[model samples]
Target: MFLSGFYGHQAAVVRGPKQPFLMETIRVDPPKKMEVRIKILYTSICHTDLRAWKGENEAQRAYPRILGHEAVGLVESVGEGVTDLKAGDHVIPIFNGECGHCPYCTTKTTNLCQTYRVNPFKSVMENDGKCRFSTKDGEPIFHFLNTSTFTEYSVLDSACVVKIDPNSPLKKTSLLSCGVSTGVGAAWNAANVQAGSSVAIFGLGALGLAASEGARARGASKIIGGDINPGKFDKGKEMGMTHFVNPKDISKPVHQISIGKGGK
Candidate 1:
């Protein structure tokens, strides 16, 4: 039985790279096996999304596409053979997919699962080459990454969706699906930032600020943040950045100034 009553809805569509998004009414097919349909509640625009939109990611370009990876939504229905999740479940759609038995997934060393890999350049369901989304006249539109949350409704592989706390605030929780997680993970897991070490983050964006916070949590001796914008300094400092370096103000690289002039 289908819990989702709606079959087609309005979506922001990009016909080509560097093109403005056009609001169009599109159709979403029913979830296939191991797939789930979701009604997007909130989707945060990410820099990665912008990059894809601006045609920076030429290798991953899928025309007439919907680009979004950070989203929080409620499961409207589960497809055949889906047992772990159900209708009405609050969920976050992830770009990464885990098979649970793959070497990368089993080792816990990486989240890049081999079983459910997706070609962001190509727009089709990982299960099959067929597109689940289409124009009102039945013209196929490519799926962005794996979850096209720019649309009002979406269908995704079950492995690409994670159940979240039902009571969690959907607006803030959406950030966890992308940028926030990327920043925190880079600092804690990849960098392995140690206590009492000096940490320097190159930018004052979300990722850099998050890295500073991670370094502070690890008891770093100093956390320096470098950015061109002076307005971001205070917010950076609040997030544990000890010093702010403005590149435009100095003749040389901010690194030379922040880290000191010489080996001495």
Candidate 2:
């Protein structure tokens, strides 16, 4: 059942690798089954976004794409069979889609559902290999990772959206959609970090800081953060990092300093 309405939205699109983003007006069709139309509220740039823009990942992506994955938005409309969410709901767009029946999804050990593995480079909706966005001149616009958060409005698979607390602050909570959550989950789920153990995390960016917090939560005795720049040390310390290591200052491996022993 088509909602019988079509709309246009503005998006920052990368025409090709290393090219400046072009603001383009795109035609968006109504949501199909198990999809939702989102009115994007806020979106942020991530290192992955930069990598895609630089064509570092071009082999895994197509051109004329809108790049963004961290986003918070409002549900403008829902497609048929979208019962768990509806219009007026606030949500975060997840780059990873979860098909409940997939082996990975059912196992609960990982977020890599096989539904997206068939064509990792294709940015189309999971249910279809086509794009819902088009240039005014009828050119197809490839989505960036399934969640083109750089657009004013976006259509997403219901499996890629998670409804959040209505009263939660949108701007801050948006971090949970990507970077921060990835870091925390890496420490908890991926590493299965043990309590009272040492954790050495490289980089002092948002992810590293979030990992520090996760380590602290797990009762890590010593959390060491390594970065080339000491400017971020204070910020990392505030996030529960017990020590900081500037790799440039140390000729030896930073991990050795944290462990105070030779390689195992």
Candidate 3:
């Protein structure tokens, strides 16, 4: 048997700056066609999760919503038409799976597919044009970002499950599903970093480090990382950063160090 919390009627409020997460439980529906049931093992905290919890972007959030996105799990069941994944397959949930046949997916312009419309604002059941999860009392709870990993178990589209090597550590691979993929893909695919080119990364947090790593892996000749924190400088250097610029001290533009002729 699978379990999940269903978000009921709850007032939204931002608790505090650092401590923003509001704990609550809500109901979620079962998987529909092309969806799958996952038994969540681990999930990671992300800035998006914190922001949504804090009500920083409350207008976009639904009440009693499950907020975590980075997650790893084992497939407990598969919906009809899902032939690729089977029961007991270890996978990482990808919130941004685009329908491969869409225009954006065809052009590789964006991963935001047009086919699937799993609304985060409404109860998962309502948006799918049917109900999958309901409170024991029959109330509906919202599913955030299609894959509500904050809960113990979640029903998600098959497109959201990326089957990885079962031997891989779920804890580490979970990070790759969202944060690592976003930062890395942004640098390599979005920015189109050429080999032997100079790259400047704006932030040095996990996303920034991932971007730097992506750039380095692509054979960037010079990778300059900038951050406000002085403590992160050493770690940035160890991560293939050729130069560290503390924006608080540097008066010149960081793009000046770019090896590319055109500013990116």
Candidate 4:
């Protein structure tokens, strides 16, 4: 149940790289200044989470870390100075947050927030360089990404949480927190793909599929996707990829397929 102070909750904790995720009772501290405590209802795994779980990067191997980002949750409570969100609000966790007042956030040319950009190495609250999660014995557990949804309750900076429609399907909207956003953002924001253009995507994973979908939404004439998996071609086609190139079958460089300077 939600309360005013330390909340005891269940969490999947990993003590070491490649170690099993042990479901344990963890003590979660209440939100700090400009932070909010969330009751995570739905969380999805992304490849980025896997990489950290496997300790592929030295920084991610920070033991006893709660590693997850893509999720939808309800605000359990709000901390001091938090105005945009409150208890009972449905929200999504954003690894890269926009502070709203930052010059980058104020300008239309970029979406990055000056103070709260996505930092994989960041494992503590911005207000104070410390964690809000701890083991039953009071051993501090590090955080993963900005949104550590592996636990039942996670404390996030107010900027990292975005309020969503109360009636929205959280299971579907959960995709927006990571892979889907990464892919769509690439096509729509980074590339600024113009209509009737040819788009070539190197990978056909969830990110690639979402990118193809975004390109399709923008009226791209051709969307060419390259991947080692032949099984993914059908799904890619369904997502608006018009052509598929198997790198295993192609003997020459894939980029020589006549992409214009304007192509993404």
Flag regions of model 2 displaced more than 4 Å.
1-5, 117-120, 251-264
> In candidate 2, what residue range of length 10 has the lowest lDDT sum?
255-264
- lDDT for predicted candidate 2 compared with the true structure: 0.83
Candidate 2 structure quality by residue, lDDT tens digits, 15-126:
8889999988888868888989898998988988898888875477587888898999999888999999988999999887787887898897437788643234768876
In candidate 1, which residue pairs clash? 60-121
Off by over 4 Å in 3: 1-29, 117-127, 251-264
Q: Give all candidates' CA lDDT scores.
A: 0.82, 0.83, 0.71, 0.86
lDDT value, residue 61 of candidate 1: 78
The clash numbers for all candidates, in the given order, read 1, 0, 10, 0
Which residue window of length 10 is worst by lDDT in model 1?
255-264
Q: Write the per-residue lDDT of candidate 1 for residues 1-264, one digit (tens) a residue.
A: 355334468889999989999999888888888899998999989887898898886777778898899999999888888999999999999987787777888887447778666556757887887888888788888887788899899999998999999999988999888777887787888888888777778888888887888788888877778788888988987998876677676456546644564211
**Cα lDDT of model 3 by residue, 60-159, tens digit:** 7555456678989899877767889988999998777666787777885546677544344543532365444445576555566667777667778787
TM-score attained by model 2: 0.91
Best by TM-score: 2
Error of 4 at 171 (Å): 1.5
